[model samples]
Target chain A: MSDSSSILGSTAAPDREAHLTPAANKLYGLMAEFESPAQIVAAAEKVRDAGYRWWDCHTPFPVHGLDQAMGIRATILPVLVFFGGLTGTIAALVLQIFTNAMSFDLWAIVWVRGYDYFISGKPMNSLPAFIPVTFELTVLLASLTVFFGLLLLNGLPRLYHPVFKSQRFARASDDRFFLVIEAKDPQFSRTKTEAMLQALKPLSIEALDS
Target chain B: MSTLVIDNTWDDPAKRAPLVLNHDRFDTVTAEICRVNEEAKPPMAWYVTFGISLALLGLLGVMVMYLLATGVGVWGNQHPVMWGFPIVNFVFWVGIGHAGTLISAILFLFRQKWRTAINRFAEAMTIFAVMCAGIFPAIHVGRIWVIWWVFPIPNQMDMWPQFRSPLIWDVFAVSTYFTVSTLFWYVGLIPDLATLRDRATSKVKAIAYGLFALGWRGSNRHWHRYERAYLLLAALATPLVLSVHSVVSFDFAVSQLPGWHTTIFPPYFVAGAIFSGFAMVVTLAVPARSLWGLKNFITLRHLENMNKIILLTGTIVGYAYAMEFFIAWYSGAIYEQFAFVNRAFGQYAWAYWIMISCNVITPQLFWFKKARTSIWIMFIASLLVNVGMWFERFVIVITTLSQDFLPSSWGYFTPTWVDWLTFLGTFGLFGTFFMLFIRYLPVIAIAEVKGVMPQADPHYGEEGHEHESEHAFGFQPRRPEDKEEDQS
Candidate 1:
């Protein structure tokens, strides 16, 4: 209860903190609110240098350099999407070749045999005829991977987060910038993290509910 | 209007015009865009337009019901001209969707910053237009319920669609196009939905937007992968746009008919798709920006840029027409020559000329800066381009089908009331989706638009942003700080 005691009431001079109220419950993290990208990007550098693992800088938009400032590495999404497309390509080829040119038993609930059907005098195993569908399937699977793959990686469609429990965190989608160092982080401490955040000169720092 | 147009914007790169006008801040952009969705009362035009669209949609539903009950006989697809109004409408709608994907994918790849303001709306248009397009083919099969036969899924009939067939390729092409485009559109929308969720004034608004926002917290960690995923989608969607229209063209070009079979169809159709797609974007944008007070974001410069694209693609379409004629004559194939000559001078010459004038001559007006910047001129030209593109599909489908090789089975295909109403009803379907879109969703890409602003730069204020951002990482060396101020 003492942790969230309107860290607001204690640090009310900044005026920008007028809208920020840290709700009381279990201490989730320490949140530092900033007014601009410059401030947060600078603050992020210090936080990263402080060696906290479970810290994230939130902003209204993707700050151009904040990733580099935080030492974030490039993602493996492109490689994943590439393999995803290859799977689609292989799937399309097997589906077409087996269904149109070769006979094979495909098992589902029961056996469904695919027999070759000769039509329009084309060869039984024509690759040219199959190219269009193959291309479509390649794109379809690659895109699905990008879509679902991105969400799964991001841990999205999560309806609730402890940061969302903070009234000031609403501005994360608006004008303000935020630095959240979760209590679960090994480097996160009551006095030290709050002191490091205070040294960044953010308008306000609040202890959010878990 | 002239003041808003911002002519002479490029005398120097140092004093370039801002993409978002009126010196807007982050909150203002959100406020301006979110106000429309948050407002309890929309303009009376929203009501009137939605009413008309709903009525037209009702007409389409009735016509489709009539067709389903009475059979494809209710429309005028007869012996020679079997691909009548339905095929024409199908190609036209599909082509219209190309602009949306082109804006979202191709322009984004090219790093066109202006697209951020309009891509969301255009992509929404693409999804809706594709939905309208799917209706015709699904119902065109006569046995509406058996339409799944188009896909390769094994049914109890134990049949596979002929992979060698262009029609079967079209089935795969369009369904895949729809699914991928919807994925791309929804992926782009997730961030904005989070904005709406945060800005929600009511519990229902919160729930609706929250469900879609997927608990986005503007996390840089998430954005790192999200940005990569977006780039991947854009790369995938770019070729997908070209292939979709190309495959649709294959439905005609792969056929043996003289007018229908042409190697040039793919490029020509893709060009025309971009041409008409830009036209449709301008057509939707001119009214939307004005209606929603989004003039600051969807500025005239964006419209002018779109007009230039229209001019380019339209001329390409014209060249394709001339090439088609020249190729037909040069082939020394009598049927091909007859197809070209008859198209220009035959009984259906009126439709051919309408296509030429609207698709070719109309966009020529954009060569004049006055026409491109003038809202009225560009809007009318866009409308004309749309009309011309529709007739181009018509001329292609009808001329080729009506008098191909056998004059014995020649039939002048006239669409019944069902065909006319059904086509018009698609407009209703497109409009209804658009109306709903503008009503609830953020029409502009809120975060993306913010990303382009100078304020988004980390070193925005201090030594200016552009200079430091020359580094690929946009990282700048930190300056010595005053420890006294921090300890104050």
Candidate 2:
């Protein structure tokens, strides 16, 4: 029974491989495990110089200078957040003014909704009073932008990735630093990429299966 | 081949004190921090405290129900002292909430690395304390059902909450504070939650943690955005913290009352809030560190640093107290002078003295290294500071209300049993939430703690590797005598 099962297992392996598509048969990426962040960073610089677009470095924590090493441009999140804050400030000022200071004229019928009532002898359009809420709203919208902007930019809430299929990828959040050159990269060729990574003297290399 | 000799003097483990002790590895940090959750069974002390907290929370519910069924009169609130315990408690709890934001957001922006150990629990405390703080104003409004009236939503009644009123400003300020703080905290927790999700042994645990993690993979792209978001949130929260308590002060400062009405109130109140908040953090952390076996992570240095903050804020609060008196005298406003005089030596002078002794006098001990480092001293000092902060609010609210310009209306305010119970019950609520937090969540940020370790640096001990390997591998050629002995 054991001999027969072993024979069956041997036969099933090729059958699975044969059933796979060409894209699936090809490696998902070449993942090189570096012993240290500096090693991965140095490797990243070399990879960047070699003009690999679809590649990334993964470390347990963000390594300083790694972004520069990988040649990643600065994100536009700050610009988005700044506009968000500006919108909040303007929106707050308009809301307060329209509600408290300005009268609404609808087809020659003046609505009394924007009643200019005096509060503690202060004018209806008290800009000083408006400042607190304006500041609060500015912060609120800017922070919300920062949060949502991050999620949108990173394309996060992504529950799955091909990288998870590699057994060694789990250590990316622990002790290891990894540089993956995606199969889809223009410069990528299985033998050439493997040889290039091997020349870097990485601790280990794995072909991630999609 | 010329080998690279990396200069690693800056990354030397011996040069810097370890944030995490026992020479922890990355996996060990995860295992240690996650141990409480993995064990799944809390110790007996946790159960006992949690049980007590739940009981107190139940009592608070009962009190609320009773007060709602009757009226605001069920509390000690009366004509002369309408603000009573509810407002005082509101301000006190709100003050307690500030320390968390200060530690997490302010310290983060300042680049204080020590905050990582305690920031998680402190942030949790802020959320829970705000919940407790929020309850008072809602219930204090008497018709808790119509609390939505505070919002600027268009209603058929055609009345907008007076936007100019600082009380209305409070509604915006506090709700905004809660929203921002919760977001900041949850954002920080996401990566840590993913770490927890990956380590979870049970299927149920894995799914639950995984869902909250929002499919975080710790991808480089994700981390880049996360870091940016975190920094912006910290920057945003810093001003929000100062603005929150400043606005809360506006609740009193905008009023006509002698003691409450002052330009100094905003800065004074902000300082007091931070002081009380730090005290509460120390109060919670001391027992928690021992209870959870988290001494190594929440180290003496962290405690000492917190004590130093307490000292600084405590002194500021003291200065504020003196400044109030000097300004009151300098302003030559009879009402202000009377109010200051009455607070220190009037019907409720005992309460004033308690506030002074606890908040001002006791914390001065923290100025000494021995006192700051000593567990017992810090614990007692923290508890006293909490007491002093509570009395400080009471002195501000009750004393001023109890004795106004009209001597005819002046009366001594005394809290009814229900008022005391309700205040005590918030403790239960805060404890219950905190106990649950530590029981389930990663109390210390596992990822953050590991991030600060020496091994996390690529250049750590790079220069010493060859010398260490000689001793470790013993690769020196074996002597001929040793070979002959082996042959014999």
lDDT of 1: 0.85
Candidate 1's residue-wise lDDT over B82-162, tens digit each? 999999999999999999999988888877777988999999999999999989889999998888788777777778888
**TM-score against truth, every candidate:** 0.93, 0.90
Model 2 chain B is weakest, by summed lDDT over 10 consecutive residues, at B467-476
How far in Å is the alpha carbon of B96 misplaced in model 2?
0.9
lDDT of each: 0.85, 0.81
Clashing pairs in model 1, backbone N/Cα/C closer than 3 A:
none
lDDT digits (tens) for residues B1-488 of candidate 2? 14422222133665555566664367767777788777868889999999999999999999999999999988889989999999999999999999989988888877787788999999999999999999999999999889998876666555566778788788888988998899988888887787776666666676677678776766665565667778888889999999999999998898899999999999999999999999999999999888877877888878888999999999999999999999999999999999999999999999999999999999999878889888999999999999999999999999999999999999988899999999999989998999999888989877677767766655557876421111100112333332110000
Candidate 1 local lDDT, A2-31, one digit each (tens) = 122132123234234445654333477999
lDDT of 2 at B250: 92
- On lDDT, the candidate that comes out on top is 1
DockQ in order:
0.39, 0.26
Give the C-alpha miss distance for residue A29 in model 1, angstroms. 1.1
